[model samples]
Target: MIHQVQRSTQVGRTTHSPKRRVTPIYAPGRRHPVGQVVGDAFIKHIAFSKHTLRSPRAIAFDVSTLDDAERAGAVVAEIHDTESRNVWTAPIALIRSKGFPVRRGFGNQWALTLEHWSRNGLQSEAEAREEQQAAKQAAASVVQLGLFGGGL
Candidate 1:
């Protein structure tokens, strides 16, 4: 009697219910997502390109982090492109720095400004040049200190 009453009380379904779409990254102070960037810092945003909107960038899926898909400071990202599709185990930093902005998505909350991207590019280039200069100076010192190599 209870089983029949329970079934009868349920007035039947009107439409199909869909599951809520969960995003991988979220604003700070919120519940942590499944994919954690490194330790506690979540992946704030992702950008890929040579610092321009025209450049090609990898598409990042809101994927959950797998146990074997991570290294010290990198993660295995699935690369999907027009030419070819391959798996790239790149540093997390690179992935975020090069990611491009999407016209539409979860919203600006998931995207970084183009200015930030430009600045990052410039900073990395500057660091590279500085390292080269340091290396050259070191080589010159090595040569100067060689046997009978001190000033003529």
Candidate 2:
């Protein structure tokens, strides 16, 4: 039970009260429609460019967080652009940040933002993974020195 303290009209007096729980009024599932068009009217007024839409071919927002995918912090979204006869893949974040409303099915706004990034030329997932791996390897190869000023 949730409670709130209310100040009484009489000075130096208060009462403990329970607040009523409010339920959602909308259909539980209509929360976040994936790729649901934001429309030209809305996009045009925004700060970002609308005319320079992300390459339809390169916008693959992969949503996965299993094993290596989680370790790498992103997953490969292999989007096949049939009209262009080209396949493009981009990395989308696994753990999302705050602010974007959590969707009903898809979970949160991270994937949606990733989709926007993919449309605006985010790097390929494969390349990002490769770079991350290389960085790890380089860090591991570094020699650690002892506090005594000699290799222990």
Candidate 3:
């Protein structure tokens, strides 16, 4: 019967089968777990760039939101005397790292906002001074008590 059907189909007047479309599986936004993988990807692509890690004259970001609450993010950097700005981008999955704070939007979509950009570096003078003060305070709190006077 199968051979007969094959022959008949070859002869004439056969209906063509529709092509099956494949949909991709994506992590659910509401419960998606962002972990080290996401953070690593973000750091490798975005944070590791000298243009991003170093202090630029100015920095800006453009975020385009999608229907699925996915976003396309880009960092724009303006360097002194540069004719064009440098643009850095990272995967949406990476940008949605667990470390970042996200909020629910009007449509119950998750969104992250960029507030400021700064270089990653050691502590500033003021911060160092404050740290030294804290250390001194901690040391002062330790009492000598003169051994035998308290416990020998």
Candidate 4:
């Protein structure tokens, strides 16, 4: 099923809303329990979103309400970005033997968000792979939009 919410573009062109995937928060112990944190991890903030990956800068955040979110069937982690001293929270899972996913709320593109989230704290190669994939997808979408007159 397609959700049809229409909005006017800058050029007054009508376009259907992009497909959105609402992902649950990243809890440590759903499929598997949280493993002992090895150490302070230095992971890259990676994403290829609709909006320019702005400054790729960081800022502080307060995730004081996630406990209440559990009742809604999701979990979150408040992580501080040491580089920018920013704290961020997201509804992504950090499963054992898996990568952590923290969406920057950039777009509704699930694939775009997935690569970054999965690569955020996983293997180093994850960043490169996800970034490449997201860039390709974003480029493809742009071409599609251009070809289709920006409706799809």
CA error at residue 113 for candidate 4, angstroms:
22
Cα-based lDDT for every prediction: 0.36, 0.31, 0.29, 0.34
lDDT per residue as tens, model 3, 1-152: 00001111222454764333211212334232211122112211233233221222222222212212222111222122122332233335433441133232323233222222212333334446778999987665554434336423
Candidate 2 residue pairs that clash: 54-119
Give per-residue CA lDDT, model 1, range 22-117, as digits (tens).
224333334644233333223333333421233232344332232212332224332222233222233335445654445544333122223222
TM-score of each: 0.26, 0.24, 0.21, 0.23
User: What digit string (tens of lDDT, one per residue) describes model 4 on residues 1-105?
Assistant: 111223332333646544432323222223421111111221123122322233332221112113223333344433444455433433324421243223565
Task: Tell me which of candidates 1 and 2 scores higher on TM-score.
Answer: 1
Q: Model 3 TM-score? A: 0.21
Candidate 2 per-residue lDDT over residues 1-152, each given as its tens digit? 11122332333454644443221111124452222111111011111232112433122112321122333222333333434434333333322331133333533322333332333356645457778999987665554334446553
Q: Candidate 4: where are CA atoms >4 Å away?
A: 1-95, 99-123
The most accurate candidate by lDDT is: 1
The local lDDT score (0 to 100) that residue 140 gets in candidate 4 is 92
lDDT of 2 at 120: 31
User: What C-alpha lDDT does candidate 1 achieve relative to the native structure?
Assistant: 0.36
**What's the CA error at residue 13 for candidate 1, in Å?**
48
lDDT at residue 105 of model 3 (Cα atoms): 39
Best by TM-score: 1
